[model samples]
Target: MDLTHSAQDEAFRREVRDWLETHLSGDFAGVRGLGGSGREHEAYDERLAWDRHLAAHGWTCIGWPEEYGGRGLNAARQVIFHEEYARADGPGRVNHLGEELLGPTLIAFGTPEQRDRFLPGIRTVEELWCQGYSEPDAGSDLAAVKTRARLEPVSEPGGPRQWVVHGQKVWTSLAHLADWCFAVVRTDPASTRHAGLSYLLIPMHQEGVEVRPIQQLTGTSEFNEVFFDGARTDASMVVGAPGDGWKVAMGTLGYERGVSTIGQQIRFARELDAVVALARHNGTIDDPAVQDRVTRARMGLEVLRLNALRMLTGPASATPGHEVAIGKLLWSTWHRSLGELAMEVAGAASLTAHAPPYELDDFQRLFLFSRADTLYGGSNEIQRNIIAERVLGLPREPKP
Candidate 1:
């Protein structure tokens, strides 16, 4: 794929840069750099308002097709937008689950009715979404999911039908704030493993559903335990045919690492810069070990960027295969190491909270929260399994 920017691409970059510079001032200035991985709880309301502000200006979901209320930008322009957004230190997006992951999945695998019903809300940031993939028993072993969803029979002539869901999902990011959840549940009671699973879109506001926040190592509750007790959505809400959820779910995973990754890499660059700056300020830069680690971090980040570009070289809508696991493994391991490096740079001061009630400084929180970086999304072990068994065409690991 051509990495060179054409005149048009450069012009688009200027447009994104100018727009962010103009709008991310005055009222929006406080939100600049306010929310990210460990800091998502910071200025949330302000950042949400800023998200809606972007949606109103046709800035959200720019890569989506125009008919779906997007700008229908090509991949190059989309990268430019994310790059500029990160460069300007724009606040972390509130609707990434909706806009980046689910939106694309629906576009690729969902029925036309699904698109017509859901795309507008996602485009406008009127609805927020949370992934419902991980469960207490089935985090990386997704096919082992035990959550069950059964279609309710029509009670009377022409009465509305719905699917009743019952199960618990753990580590549901942003579940407390989401209006909807796209989940994988067992639609067939007898079918085992990857078969008989269906991807269902369930509403979060119903009485049958409950959300309990899980406070993390960062002292924040961005993740949650979601309990669905007879929760109902329209019978037609399943993304693909029932018992075909494994495929649709995999498609969503493919979209998980998409164009927004460019912005993420940019954020990582900023974090590395902060670590280096801290090392300098505290004289840790004088340590040969510190200098070497920092240098290695920089190199790993470049490798990350190049790998991301390679992963994204295909059509925007393509469903990536196991090759994408390589990217996940690399970024997660690199980030976790950066967190450790951060604590080292702080010397002994890293051991304590900055204030009462577990207030951690930036590096402390980074160190704490990033410990899960390798665990969530997909575990490092899981990624390696994918790379080995699928990408490298090696034999599968022995199953007990």
Candidate 2:
């Protein structure tokens, strides 16, 4: 792929940059670089307002089709938008589950009615969403999900049938703040593994549903444990066909690794720059080992960007191939290593908190939170398994 941008692309980039510079000031000025990964709890309401600000100006979902209430930006322009957003240190998006993952999945697999019902909410940032993919036993082994949702008649006469979901989902990011959850549930009890699963759109505010925040080592509750006693959605709320959830869920995962990753790498670049600056301040930059690690981190980031671009240029499919797994493995490992590097640069000071009430400095937060980088979003082992089985055409792992 050509690395150089066309004049038009450059012009679009400038437009995005100017808009961010102008708007990410005044009331939104303090929100830059707030809310991301382990730090998602920061300025959440304000960040949400910032997200709406982007949506109001027609900046959200730039890659969705124009009819779906997006800018309908092509691949190049989408990349430009994300890159510029990160360059301006835009607040971490609170609506990504809606915009990046679920919206695209719906567009690809949803019925027209489903699209009309959900797309506008996502595009306008009026309703927030959380993913219900991971469970206590099914984190990386997504196909092993045991959450069951069975359709039953509504109590009101002639009302629509409802999917009564009963199970628990752990590591549900931002569930407390979301209005809805797209969950993978076992709709067919007789079926096993990936066969019986269905992707159901569940409402979060109902009495049968409960969201309990899980405080992390970072002293924040960005993730939650969501319990569903008898949570429900309209029977028609399932994306794609009922038993075809394995396909829809995988498609959402593909979207999870989509064009927005370019922006993510830009953020990672910023984090790396901070680490290097810290090293310089602490005189660790003069140490050959620290300098070597920093240089390696820089090279790894470049490689990650190139790989992501390569993936973007490939055929647009909901089912991501081994390349996605490779990218996941690359970035997660690199980020975890960068965190360790941050601590090494901080020297002994990393051992202590910066203030009372257990306030951690930026470097400390980076180090502590990044320990889970390889754990969540598919462990390194899982990624390797994907590469081995799918890409290398190796024998499947034995089912125990």
Candidate 3:
């Protein structure tokens, strides 16, 4: 699949690496890094700054079509971008909800007006978006969403005729900081699951919308409980046709599981290197068993990076197929093991956030997040099922 870059691709890679190295200088200083690594108040713009910086140079949406503020680079360039960004320790892009989930869906299904309205903002980090799929009752069973969106007349005096939304959404990430949210609302509850749903882009700060952050064990308010009461949106806000929401939403999830993954997969590869460095410095490498563990971890990281690259090259369509399932599952399992290795390396220092004698204090926090890796973004169990039924063509487990 031409994994080896052509001369032009090589030149492009060199150019990107040089640009990123020069602009994103080492030691993040004010950056504070990704996901609040157990430090300060998160300085909201730290993430935003990174996205804007990338957009300003037209580097943020590298793989996007040139018509929509992108370089239209090839898959190889995309891989180079991910690799260089991680090498530079670049901060996470804040436009993720827009770029990763909403923007791509718009490109595939949106009207010209929809694309014109949202894509430019997404490029410049002007409009932020959050997903509103999960609800109080429909956490993993996404088709069970009860949020209702009824059509109405534009001039009802009090009643919303455009689209009156009445429902609750929980565990919405970045809801407070977002400009909009792409929600799945039930237009016809009587219809069977995965039918009669409408995908609507709701303005987050409007009158009927309420966003209250949900605190986690980490003492952070990253996720929120969002409620909508009489939330009125224009009929134009519906993504694709009313009853075709399930299909449109499938497009959204596609980008979420695939495109958004490029940067993150590289980031975790760097984490494995950190684990190896810790093991080497902590004197544990002197023990052959620990040395073998470090070697195994390194091999696992390389396999993940290579496999992700192979997947990216094969398809433009982003379905949650067996390859993605296997990649995610391996990443989660290997990541947790690396975290445990780091703990062993740091010993008592690891428990206390790795200070003085120990290096960076964030490994433990990463370890905690890894524990949830298998749980979030569709659990490992679900991935196993996909691999079994879809990839292996195995017989389904007998139903009760």
Model 1 whole-model lDDT (C-alpha atoms): 0.92
Off by over 4 Å in 1: 157-159
Counting clashing residue pairs in each candidate, in order, gives 0, 0, 2
Q: Tell me the lDDT of model 1 at 36.
A: 86
Pull out the clashing pairs in model 2.
none
**lDDT for 345 (candidate 2):** 93
User: Candidate 2: RMSD over Cα atoms?
Assistant: 1.4
Query: Considering every candidate listed, which one attains the maximal lDDT?
Result: 1
Each prediction's RMSD to truth? 1.1, 1.4, 3.4
Residues 206-280 of candidate 2 have per-residue lDDT tens digits of 899999999998888999999999887898899989899998988888888888999999999999999888888
**What is the TM-score (0 to 1) of candidate 2?**
0.97
Listed in order, each prediction's TM-score against the native is: 0.98, 0.97, 0.88
Model 2: residue 158 alpha-carbon error in angstroms: 8.4
C-alpha lDDT of candidate 2 relative to the true structure: 0.90
